[model samples]
Target: MHRDTASQRLHGDLIGQPGSRDRLNTPALILDADAFARNVARMADFARRHGLILRPHAKSHKSADIARAQLASGAVGLCCAKLGEAEALAAEGIDGLHLTSPVVTPPGIARLAALARRIAALSIVADHPDVVDALAVAAQGGPPLTVFVDIDPGIHRTGVASPQEAVALARRIADHPSLRYGGVQFYCGAQQHIQDFAERRAAIVERTDYLSTCLAALTAADLAPAIVTGGGTGSHVIDAELGVLTELQVGSYIFMDREYSDCDLGDGGAKPFETALLVDAGVISANAPGLVTIDAGLKAFATDTGPPAILAGAGESARYRFMGDEHGAVIGPDLPGIGARITLGTPHCDPTVNLYDAYHVIRGDVLTAIWPVTARGRSA
Candidate 1:
């Protein structure tokens, strides 16, 4: 009964309403269509200018609509952090998905094998010999599986630690009739969020040296990887400058969160991207002096980076705070009126997007599209 309140069925219902956002239920995820398209075009253009492959990470938006737009913009494919995420996108007619993480669980490998049999093309990474062996067995009955050596850039998250190990893994993968040695995936996640572009570049340069050592070893052994993939929104500008990765698995740039908004991408403190994603919440109670309660709280946003930063419909002094699972508080000299809408920039975009079921795409004041978060809750 309250699904309408959540805007679950408002695709064409908000076409011509004046001040349309004011009528939305609190805690709605909205995308500024114009800003979003600009971000997409800018990234695509950058990739083209540099002659690099672009496989934008689908784990960021999780919406097939966004994925389709990216493919049309000339992205080679999309990268999924999880196999289930790839499946969700594939069910919506998406192909050319590369799984970036290694799958080790017995049940997971079985599912990966089954998924490989049906999809047009699927690739995965392996950090250990056991994982490569399992994949080789799983691919025997399906189409040949492309396997990449997940190279560790001094971070043990998932990748082969040494160049020798990478070469060994590549040889093993190549020897298998059902396994094709694809390339390497080296990603230093912490480096991407360093805030200061110069510091981030210094860190990435160090990691690139380590990756270079691995690549040299692979090349000397005649096991050189053809497609090297890794990088994220925070480090895209730097990654392009370095020229190591043949392909970029950038995630996050499409929706500038509070974190990315603060990132100095060497553009003189201005990010190359704009904040296109926002959460619309409404004031529920203004009884407290200088403070008001809002409908969006912990459940409405991702808390890993901190509280959302107030965007629109709020005064200069506005500061947001999480009050509970279903409530938040805004304190400022000037607060929004009761039942008035407020926009927010999430601290982290990827996880915050996972919390929503759909994106309410808007152009000016009109709702243009209601795109489902195709891979939401598909993190397995």
Candidate 2:
């Protein structure tokens, strides 16, 4: 399982201890087991009721345990962003992995071919013809690998630029004997974090309309994609209502982060997701009058989203600042004293999660389990 030493030691010694939560070493990743369960169930039920296949992205949690939980709750499979993440999970016996990003390099393609042999339903994306041609050669090296033509919805990041280009690629994929043209992948990553619900929905509709054109073109050419995938947590509802994606690539709803929490979820004020994932940082120094230093800093949390949010103790005006790689200061009135444990909300769940080696799973005050982040550094 590639479990970290601290997590392994703690799991054996501190599990079932009355104050296990308090005894956790500083700057530890925490997951409220009950809340996490509820989050998983809610997303699964939503997908079931809506008639959408749920293939939640494993890139967010990166834990085989979490991925299994999602599968138990009716998720069809797990979607990964990197080949390394898929290989790591496959080693743990996880199946139905679909790589969202393209593997264009010679070595990456060879690895992709190898992974396809290891995993029965391994699928990948192709944004360019050279990538497709290379994948065709690799597919012959292993079993027939499922390839999804990545359709770019004006992001200019990846995928075929136009509907004509998409259709051409789909045709090219069909010509290859060891390749299966599964479908198209249109992920609007840029629109997922739009603060306002209406604005986010508008952005999704625009992209969804663009995807429809690609789908229509492919269908007209008798190359209709059997599985249309790609819709993130932020745009899940909007994308579902649009009736395009057959399956969802929703991630981050399991561990509601500050970025997704700030977005208007159409409930007026309440978020659709609960804050299940958290960082438990201990107060190190309280000598500063209005601010107290915490054990978690840049190294503990992701710096891309500014700073972590104090879930309690610090008032509404509380502002977290990065002091150093190993330390952070929470500036606000009536801060917690030294040794007091502070729960923090991550700004960006995916990257913030990558910083930790294990998750200290808590069911109330007891340490239930210590799930290792098996794919922590498997960013290949």
Candidate 3:
């Protein structure tokens, strides 16, 4: 086992001491410690009140420290997008890790089996018979592998197409002695950001109805799943109300991004979770009037959703435009002079987080801690 003292020393060196946030380098990812704590508590309380299992997706933050905080806040487990991510968290002693995506390749299955032996409980998703067979063969002499049937809820990404397909896959998993059928993973990745509350609810209702059909088929075949896990930060409330989702895999709630902020929460109010994640960029040049250039550009934050929003400093009202790979332009009146710092909120948290090496954790303008992005490049 990894030593606790060694881990503390390494984190201590990475974080150093709590002091002014200005002392840190520019264009770094910063986490508001207070806001982060509040977000964790809020999500945990919501899950507890609704009687839903909270399995926050680690793909959003990818920091073991953040995962520990979520687990401490009453999360049942952590969900990862890839085997490398699961391996990184497992190395830090995070048990109950579940891979949200399916693994069908022989080499990936072999690595996952190896990780299963080390962790207390590891689960993965499957939408095809080939993946089921490969996983069963991989777990021949190892411990029983838990598997969830991936149900494509209108996303058509990677899951079984129909209820009949889901039942057949569940039966095949049960037939394998090395595999234990966990449940169904019905996630609508595209529906999460629907701007209208009624639209979001309609999308989830349609998906949940399909899920109920799969559940009934599974029960008829005497393969009733013990867990029905699928729901994101956007539709957790709706999923809980439908009475089908046993656990919620909401990840981005910990760090609200501009895309989530733009989404309606079924109510004309702000998101319950605070915007805890920010990118600190410094004014590199103020050569032009009413315009200042920052060091962060397309490379600093994810541009697929949109440009990053200025959260603090003189650039709050400024319009952010991508200047180049290494630079961004903030155009507005009374822009900050050269060397001044500004906080930028990412358009999307997950991919934006992948760009950073560590989080400069802060509490009231003082850098309190630094958590390494342990799973930053764990896409393999």
Best lDDT goes to which candidate?
A: 2
Give the per-residue Cα lDDT of candidate 3 at 120.
84
* Candidate 2 ranges beyond 4 A from true positions: 2-4, 267-269, 313-317
lDDT of each: 0.88, 0.89, 0.88
Candidate 3's displacement at residue 72, Å, is: 0.7
Cα displacement (angstroms), candidate 2, residue 146, comes to 0.3
Residue by residue across 1-380, what tens digits does model 1's lDDT show?
11222455654477556667666666889999999999999999999998889999998998888999999999988999998899888888888999998889989999898888878889999988888998999889779999999998776787888999999999999999999999999988978878777788899999998999999999999998999999888778778888889999998889988888887876465568988999999898999999999999999999999988998888987999999999999999988779888888889999999898888888888777678888889989
Better of 2 and 3 by TM-score: 2
Which is superior by lDDT, 2 or 3? 2
Clashing pairs in 3: none
> What TM-score against the true fold does each predicted structure earn?
0.96, 0.97, 0.95
Tens-place lDDT per residue, model 3, 1-380, is: 32333323434454545566776667888899999999999989999999999999999998899999999999989999999999998898888999999988889999999999998899999999988999999998989999999988876889999889999999999999999999888887888999888899998899789889988998998888899988898898788788899999999988999988888864566678889999999999999988899999988999998898888877456888999999999999868889999888989999999997888788876777778888889998
Best by TM-score: 2
Please give the lDDT score at residue 58 for candidate 1: 94
